[model samples]
Target: MTASPNRGLALTVGAILAIWGILGFFFAGEGGHAFFGNEGGYLWGVFLVNPALCLVWTLLAAAMLIGGLGTTIGSRNLNLLAGVVLLVLALYGLLFMNTSANVFALNAVDNGFNAIVGFVLLLTALAADRENLRALRADRDDLDALRAEAAHG
Candidate 1:
């Protein structure tokens, strides 16, 4: 029942994204914008988003929330996974920011934000839970030694 920093981060990010995702629908398609169009309105006058992006955000948020509410290991793993995915998505979005391939309606701001969040998640997952990591490593080492002794015997 150890509390993970990743859990806190996941919960906070998940909640914020959930709220943004819901509000995003209201401003998604402004003036006949396509569902996956490059053109989109800003969420809270900051992050550019469309229906597709909102859906993606909502899905990610759900995952984060669920992970946060689960075991510490679950949160850490989820953060790692989500961070990698977000980083890749951010790179893709940045590359196709102004193209028709930008189905998520991602802009520079969104890409930047995604990159930042991704990095944060990744770093936290790798750096946090030191005690658990040490214990796990120690357990593995002990297991290895036991196995070696059993094989020799």
Candidate 2:
């Protein structure tokens, strides 16, 4: 299949997230914070991170990479799923950032990043895959028509 926007975004974002997650581990608990607490140190003095958050990002990166390496529909669907999940996480982080409930050690920057990336993923998946879907359906219909014609002939 042709390279779609969703596929490209998924691969690119997944790679970046994977790298960040991996590197974040080296700095996790730098100040002796809890594994899941919000008091973890900053990554590159920007993004707040912890072991749990790194694990989450690694898992998310896996999903994104799997989707990106699969079919177009798979990429789009995974992007949508990831988008929704990230948006929810963003909201949760915003609400519990400074509380004990901040299990992912999220901060304002993380929440904002999640929200923006989530929105972009959602928008790209929803609005950019129409042509691909239509083309796929057309191909399937053509294949079916050809099979029927062969059987009848």
Per-residue lDDT, model 1, residue 136, is: 69
What candidate 2 gets wrong by more than 4 Å, as runs, is: 145-153
Q: Which 10-residue span in candidate 2 carries the lowest summed lDDT?
A: 29-38
Candidate 1 regions off by >4 Å? 136-153
**Candidate 2 CA-lDDT value:** 0.89
Give the CA lDDT, 0 to 100, for residue 104 in model 1.
Answer: 89
Which lDDT tens digits does candidate 1 get at residues 28-114? 977767888888888878888999888888898999999999867789899999899889989999899989999988988889888
CA shift at 114, candidate 2, in angstroms? Answer: 0.8
The global C-alpha lDDT for each of the candidates, from Candidate 1 onward, is 0.87, 0.89
**TM-score of every candidate relative to the true structure:** 0.84, 0.90
On lDDT, the candidate that comes out on top is: 2
For model 2, residues 58-152, the per-residue Cα lDDT tens digits are 88899999899888889999999989988998999999998989988999998998899889999999999798889998999999999999999
